[model samples]
Target chain A: MLRNTPIKRKLTVIILLISTAVLLITCAAFFAYDLFTFRQSMVAHLSTLAEMTASTSTAALAFDNPKDAQETLSALKAEQHIVAACLYDKDGKFFAAYPANSPTNNFPTAPEPAGLRFEGSYLVAFQPAMQSGGLQGTLYLKSDMGALYERIRLYSLIVLLVMLGSFIVAYLLSSLLQSQISQPLLQLAETAKAVSERQDYSVRAAKLGRDEFGLLTDAFNNMLEQIHNRDLALQEAQQKLRQHADDLEKRVAERTARLSETIAELEAFSYSISHDMRAPLRAMQGYSDYVMENYGEKIGPEGQQYLQRINRAGMRLDTLIQDILSYSRAARAQMDLHPVDLEKLLDDIIQQYPGFQPPQVEITIEKPLGSVIAHEASLTQVISNLLGNAIKFVQPGQTPRIKIRAEPRGDDLRLWFEDNGIGIASKDLNRIFAIFERVHAERTYEGTGIGLSIVRKAIERMGGQVGVESELGKGSKFWIQIKKS
Target chain B: MAVLGNILNPSKEASNRRFTHRLRACLAGFIFLLLAINAPAQISREYQLKAVFLYNFAQFTEWPPDAFADPQAPLVIGVLGRDPFGAYLDEAVRGEKINGRPLIVQRYSGIQDVQNTHILFISDSESKHLLPILASLQGRSILTVSDMEDFVPRGGMVRFLTTNNKIQLKINVNAVKAARLSISSKILRSAEIFPPAAK
Candidate 1:
C-alpha cells in the first residue's frame, strides 16, 4: 500500500517511532527507580534482621548454652528469605547453628568474622552478639535474594505491554490523520495530469483543508484561469489573422480582374485603329505605284522622282502599321501552352525563313533542344524575331554568324541565341524589350523597332522571361527561359 | 580439701572410711555404666571438657580481698554432696592459681560446710541441697555453680548444660549480686544470665 501512498506511510511510521521511543524511555526510567529502591530496601531489611538476631542471641552465646543459641537462630526460619543462621562464641569458633534442613552439613567448620556481603544468590550478614562491655560472639544470617529478580521480571513484562499499546494507538491515529495530507495532493496531481493531456486549463484541484494544500489549490486555480484567458486570446488573434488574409486575397483578385479588362479594352482600341489605318495606307501605296509605273515618260524626271519617294513613304507606313498590330496582338491575347518539339520547330523555322539558310548568314544548334512547355505561336514568334534581328544587325562586310543552343536551368530551359552583330550599349540594353523601344536609327537598321518588344510580351504571356547581354563591338546573346515539360 | 583431692585423682587412694569402700564399688559400677552407654568415648570427652571449663571459671573470676585468710591462702572450689565430676575438677585446678593465690578444691556434705568457699559447684547428685547451698552463699563473696535444670533461676551464680553436643553456661546476676561476688564480664558474656535487669 505504501508504494503508491508514501506520504501516508511515512506519517504513520514517524508517529509510531516517536511514541515507541517515549514509551521506552518512560518505562526504562520507572524500571530503574523501582529496581534501585527495591535493592536498597532489601539491604535495609537484611540489616534490620541481622541487628535483631544479634541482640536476641547475645545472651545465649554468652551463656554457652548451645541449645538456647540454636533455638534463637531457629527463629529466623520463620522469615521466608532466611536460609541459615549461626552463633559463634567470642573465640570465633563455631558454637551453635540452625540450618534449614537439619544435620548442618553445609555449615563451615569455623565462623567467619563479622561483616555483611552478598554471595551468589544469598545475602550474608555477620553481626557481633554484643552486651554491656562485652563481645560474646558473632551471628551469621544468610538471606535468599531471588525476590528482587522476580520483581524485575514483572516490571519488564509491564513495560512491554505499554510499548505495544502505545505503538498501536500511534499507528491508528497516524493512519486516520494522514488522509488529510494525501487526499488533496492526489487530487492536485490528477488535475494537473488531466489539464496537460486535454490542453484544457479549466480543471481545478479540490481543497481538503485550511492549510498549505488549500493555498496550493488556490494558486493552481489562479494559474489555470490565466492560462484559460491566454488560450482564448491566442485563438481570437489567429482567427483575425486568417480572416484578414482571406479578405486581402479576395480584394487582390477583384483588382486583378478589373485591370485585365481595362488592358483588353485598350488593346482593342489600338488593334481596331491599326486595322482601319491599314486600308487607307494600302490604297495610297497601290495608287502611288500605279502612277509611278504607268506615267513615267508623260511626266518629267522631277515628277518621276517625286512619285518614287511617295511610293517608298507609303510602303514604310504600311510596315509600321503591320508591326504595331503584331505587337498589340502579342500583349492582349489568351495564353495556350503545350509541349512542343523545339528541334522540329527550329528546323521548320529554318525552312520557312530564307534568311536562315547558310552562306549569307549561318545558324547552328550547339546542342539538341529538349521539348518544353510553351505557347506554340508565341514561341515561334519569339524565336523568329530573335533570328531576324541577329541577321539584320551585322557589320557591313561580315556575314551574320548566329548560334542557337538550349541548356537546363533548374526546372526550366535557357534557350540561347548568339549573333555576330553590333551589341547595344549598356544604358539602352534594359529598354530594348520595351514597346517600340530601339537603339539603332530606322534607316540604319532597315526594320521597325517593335521586334524585340513583341518578343518580350509574347514570351512573358507564355510564362517565360527574355533578356539580352552584350558589349559594343562584340556580339549579342539573347536568352528565353521556358519551363521544361 | 582432702576429700576433694581424692575426688580429683582416683590414684590418690584417699583414706575415707566410707569413700574408699564406695569408691571401689562405684568404680565397678562406672565400668558397667561405661559399657552400657551408646557413645561412652564422646560422653566422657564432653564431661572432661565441662570439668576443665569449671576450673577455668575459677581461674578467671575475682573474689573479695578478705575472702581468703591471707595473701598466700588458696582459692577454694567446693563440690557439694555426690561428686559427679569424679576426680576431673581437682585434677584441672591442681597447680593453678588466681591473683597470686594457690587454687584448692573442697567437697562438702551439706550447706553448713560451704564457708570460705570462692566457687561452690553443686553436683547433680545433690540437686535436693541446691536451695540451702544458695542460701548459705547469699551474703558471702562465694560463687555458687550447678549443673541442674533451672539452677540459675533458683539464685545460683552459674550453671552448665549440654545441647547440640556443646557445653553451655547459664548465670543469675541477682544471685551473684546477693553474694557480693564480682563476676568478670568475659565469663558472664558466654553464660546465659537470668533476672535480666541485673546484667
Candidate 2:
C-alpha cells in the first residue's frame, strides 16, 4: 500500500512507524513492571495489618471477652480498605466481629489456615492470634481490592498520556527530518525530467550536502555537460558539409558553361572552312573543262588524261566536304517530329535516285510498312544512306536485292533493310559508324566513310536506335527503331 | 378381693411416681450435657475461664531473668488460699511452655510459700491477706492475678473481672513495674489499666 507514495511522504512514514513501535514497547514494559510491583507491595502491606490485629486481640480471645475483641477489631476502621474482620477462639468458635454488631454470616464459618491470599476482589488473611508462644485464637481480615484497582486506573492514564506525548514529538521530528533526504533526490529528478522533455542538457540539480545525493547530482551534471558538447560538435560538422556541397555544385555549373562555349566555336570554325574551300575548287574544275575542249589536239592524250584526273579528285573532295556538313547538321539540328508513312517515303526515294532503278538494284518494300513519329529530313537522310551502302557494298556482278520491312514493338516501330552484300567482319563492326571510317578501299567501294556516321547521328536525333546483323560474305540486315504513331 | 386390690394400688401408685421422677432427672441431665458440648462459651464455669485467664497472663506477661533459676526452669503458676481452679488450671497449663520454659502449677498456703512462681493467682479466700501477700512479693518478679473485687487497687498486678457474663481484665501497671515484670501491650490493649490514669 505504501509503494507509490512520494519519497518525502515515504521517509516520514517510515520514521513515524519505527518511533511509534519503540515507544509502545517501552511504555508497555514499564507499565507491566509497575503493576507487578504494586500487587506485591499491596499483599505485603495487608499481611502486616493482619498480623498486628491478630497479636493485639489474643488477650481478648483468651479471656473470653467478646467486647474487648470487638473493640480490637473495630480499630481497623481507620484503615478503610479493610471491609470486615473477626476473631475465632482456640476452640475454632466465632467470638466477636468488627463494627461491634456485624452479623455472624458476614464472617467465614471457620477460620482458614494462617496466611494472606487474594479471594475474588478482596485480599483476605487469617493470622493466628499469638502471645508469647501460644496461639490464642485466629483473626480473619477481608480487604477490598479497590485500592489496587484505583492504582491501576491511575497508572493507565499516566501511560496513555506519556504515549500521546511521545507520538506528537515523533511526528514533528519525522516531518522536519524527512526533507533532509528527499529534497536533493527531488531536485535531481526534476533536472532529469527537464533534460529529457526539452532536449536541453544545460539544466543541473543544486547540491544540498556532501552526501551520496550530492555526488549523484555531480555525476548527472557532468553527463549532461558531455552530451551538450557533442551535440554542438555535430551541428558544426553538418554546417560544414552543407557549405562544401554548395561550393562543389557552383564550380561544376561554371565548368560546364565554359566547355559548351568552346564546342560551339570549334563547330563554327569547321563550317566556315568547308564553305570557303568549295568556291576555289569549283573555279578550278571549270577552267579545266575549258582547256580540255579548246586545246584537245595541241596537248596530246597525256595532258587530257591529267586534266580528267584533276577533275575527278575535285569531285571526290566536294563529296567528302558535303558528307562532313551532313554529319555535323545531323548532330546539331533540332528535330520536330510527326507521323510519316514508311512505304511512301521509300517509294519516293527510289524514284528520285537513278542508281536504285531496276537495272542497278532490286528493291522491295513490304506493302504494309508501319508509320513512325520522326523528323522528315532526318528520316529521309537515314534511309537513303542505308540503301546506298547496301547497293554499293555488294559483290562484283551481283545485283543488290534489298528488302525493306517494318514491324511494331510495344510502343515503337522497327524498320529493317536486308541486303545481299559483302557484310562487315565482326572485329570492325563497332568501328564502322565512326566519322571517316571505311572498311573497303576507295578503288573498290568508291565512297566517303561519313555515310554510316551520318545515319547513326540522324537516327539518334529523331529518338530512334540503329543496329546491324550480318555474317561474312552472307548478307547484312540493318534496322532502326522509333516510336510508333 | 376389692379390699386387697385397694391396698396394692397405693403401693403401685407410689412406685410409678418414683419411676417418672427418675426419668425426668435423666432427660434433664442429658440436655444439659448437650448444651455444654455445643456451646463452649455458655458452659465455661467462672473459675474455668479464670484458670484460662491465668494461663493467658503467663503468656502475655514478661518476667525478668531473676524470676527463673535457669532458662529451662518451669514458669510456675501458684494458687494461694484455697485453689478455685481444681484440676482445670493443671489442664490449661499442661503441655504448655512460655518462651521455651515449661509451665508448672503450684499451691501456696500463704505468701511465704510462693517461691519460684511467675504468675501467682490469689483465690477469693486470700482476700483478707491480699495486702501482706503483695507486700512480701513486692521485690520479686511475679505477675499476681485474681478475681477479687478491686484486686488491682489492693496492690495486685492483674485481676480477672466477670462483667455481664464475659471475663475481662484489669492490670496494675505500677505494681507490675514494681515487681520488675512487664505486661505485653497486646494484653494491656484488651485490658483495663489500674492505678487509674487520674490517680
Q: Following a full C-alpha superposition, what root-mean-square deviation does model 1 have from the true structure?
A: 10.6
The per-model DockQ list reads 0.08, 0.28
Candidate 2's residue-wise lDDT over A1-485, tens digit each?
Answer: 89999988899889878988888888788878987898888899889998888887887776676777888888898998999999888878888888778888999999899998889999999999888878888999999988888988898898788878877888888889888899899999999999999999778779898889889989888999999899889889999988998999898888888877777677666777777889998999889988899987789999999999999999999998888888778877789899998888888998899998888999988879978899988899999999999999999999999999888889989899999999989888888888889888889888899999998988888888889988889889999999998
For every candidate, the chain B TM-score is 0.75, 0.76
lDDT of each: 0.78, 0.83
Candidate 1, A217-275: lDDT as tens digits: 98998999999999999999999999999999999999999988888888888899989
TM-score (all chains, Cα) for each model: 0.53, 0.61
Evaluated at residue A444, the lDDT of candidate 2 is 89
- Candidate 2 regions with alpha-carbon error over 4 angstroms: A98-107, A238-485, B1-44
Proportion of true contacts reproduced by candidate 2 = 0.68
